[model samples]
Target: MSDIFEYAPAPESRDVVDIRPSYGLFVNGEWIDSLGDERHKTLNPATEEALAEFSYATPADVDRAVDAARKAYDSVWGRMPGRERAKYLFRIARIVQERARELAVLESLDNGKPIRESRDVDLPLVAAHFFYYAGWADKLRHAGLGEDPRPLGVAAQIIPWNFPLLMLAWKIAPALACGNTVVLKPAETTPLTALAFAEICRQADLPPGVVNIVTGAGETGQALAGHEGVDKVAFTGSTEVGRLIARSVAGTRKKLTLELGGKAANIVFDDAALDQAVEGIVNGIFFNQGHVCCAGSRLLVQESVEDELLAALKRRLATLRLGDPLDKNTDIGAVNSAAQLDRIRELSDAGEAEGAQRWSPPCALPDKGFWFPPTLFTGVAQSHRIAREEIFGPVLSVLTFRTPAEAVEKANNTPYGLSAGVWTEKGSRILWMADRLRAGVVWANTFNKFDPTSPFGGYKESGYGREGGRHGLEAYLDV
Candidate 1:
């Protein structure tokens, strides 16, 4: 932590926008006070400094947001022509691009990811999502749904902290494409980008109350999830929370889609392209400091390749640079927040206590902020907690497979079925493994590749529905 603050201060930006330190709930197309006076400060996980303060939306505030959404659905959003809705989405996409720098900086500061990723990956994907869905706004009649397909009305959406602005686009773009009003809640740890999205909406001339942002912890999420006025609920978070949402909307008329936690298996066979496999494993498990829900937390290798892979992986992990997220060369950033850091620490400790051979690359972690070295554990069993549970961090648990059949069995052994990766030269094996793997998304010879046209989600306890592509509209469309 001390090391984090000890670094020289970042130079004053030449950019025009001054990042704000406080934000309010955006409801009815306006920034309003929380129904209660309570507030929570969002922090820079890199520096442990408060980057901004955001309203803690209460139950009453949720009611207000939902009512505003309902009003918008009836008076403007629902009645608006799909082409007009398409134009709004286009406008939002343009605004997002025009203000991409501001968003990327704020996202990096609050979420502690590299500025490059926020700009290149998160912001671009966000804008692309709107652009892709925008085209669909007027084409729903041809979208394979019945000719008279209608919007789901008011949608209540909750996004996780990992990819704040982009996830917001994933939820809002499709809902708007289908003509549904939205009440969105950004994760407590990273609310600045969502508030920034509200400002973008303001610039786009999006109708009052079409898109609303409420900031709070899990309780605020519960209010939105269970709100009677909400016609649909979309959530992205932990599997445990997703299950609660599943049960909450069980007997109700409200529709539900949940994108939850994953403990993905990245399998490297003896025949894999070694360099590609090494890079894939690194990116699969270490990107975003390993906070991704679809993070490949478990490393599955053919027994014959285990020793060679570990040697290369250890050498590669050792070379990664870690520190301030804004640094041009920083490959790993701080964990999202204190609580998330604790979770990672506890799991890593469990790895050591449970007798796995723990090894973290030699790197310096700042004392002023949450930081953990890129880690790996060898000699792991499927029954081990390190291998079975979703640590949601940079830690990877290693297990060796003697055969392809055993690999498939071990990969599907977990409660989660979010994603998996297979590295092999055999064409038949790729399709066969893809068939046997019980995951929503499978990467063959690649990992973590995402596109707006490709739907991404999980199976089993990883929750339901899809978040991108033509299939993504299912969550917001009326059957």
Candidate 2:
């Protein structure tokens, strides 16, 4: 589905089209400079360069975006027939596929995720999200939730920097398909793809103010969540911030959904295929530089084969290529930003300081980029800082379990119950562990499996609400 002429210059070209961090608020289908006093630089995590400058939306601007979304929700989007709405989503999906290459490249260059992942995981899931939700536009009556689950009016959504477009799609597709207009704020580290999506909305001839995107930091996000005009608030990020958002929306009429952080446990039983277990462990926490809400950051290995598995994991990690996200061969890219790199460093240091045996694969990381060697800390006790806290980087905390009961207890020990992996050949053990693990997603053999038709979310401190599948529509509905 790709061609030689699909992109600018050849694949070897370094300097691609520059989309400076846009300094404006997308409101009423137009991009206008924010009436704010401050601006921020969105950095290229790979090169540690300020790739673009962005304007911080003041509380007033957030109100304006909410007003615009409210106006569109009541006047246009809300009134549009389900079939007509479906057409717009279909158009957007087509445009995303047509320009998939550019989006894939832009996402990689901004978020510092491998281009292969952006192309494969992020982009396809984004497209499929739209495609899956689009069909439901006219089929809401048969959704099984109610006679008709109507829109929740205007939604204020805050997405993380890791999977910019994919996260955006997860929020917006369902909101729009269910007839809700949105005011979205992407993370300061990676706002490019979301801004690009605004252009895609325009290309799709989507109704004005139906999907407004505002780019900024925490203050902007706080303004969006606390604003009186928003009918719903949904966020995907840290549990700390999620708690603040929850507090802000406490007494309000607004519906809320939070897809916060995770410290998932990937448990490998003695019966697990050794090679496959190694691959699952590597992919679990190392992918996307481990900037995942449901990342398997904790490894719970059966004591019998713990040494063998750890050896293989370390060796496999060493072979991973770390470099430019744009490079096809770069298996692991830099962290999303310098701050994130610092956090990873700080956490890694804490692991060592706390007396855990920390090990980083002896891979040469690029000096210019915000890179951290894929790190693993063994002998990690549940009480250790590295084992308990969410490092949110390419860092894995390894712990051992002597029995099945101990494994389940350790796996479910964290406040996060977002996801957990069980690698085993035995069907009985797979189902047994799946039943015991208090995770929203139980990856029996695979590590990170996602689809638009599959439900995803977290429990406990990891936050609440489902993001995908037929059930995802609940968050946007009046029911």
CA lDDT of each prediction against the hidden true structure: 0.90, 0.88
Candidate 2 positional error at 207, Å:
1.0
Highest TM-score: give the candidate number. Answer: 1
What TM-score, over all chains together, does every model reach? 0.96, 0.96
Best candidate, lDDT: 1
Task: Report the Cα lDDT for residue 475, model 1.
Answer: 78
Ten-residue region with minimum lDDT total, candidate 1: 5-14
| Tens digits of lDDT, candidate 2, 170-217 | 999999999999999998888888888998999998889999998889
Clashes of each: 7, 1
Candidate 2, residue 324: lDDT: 79
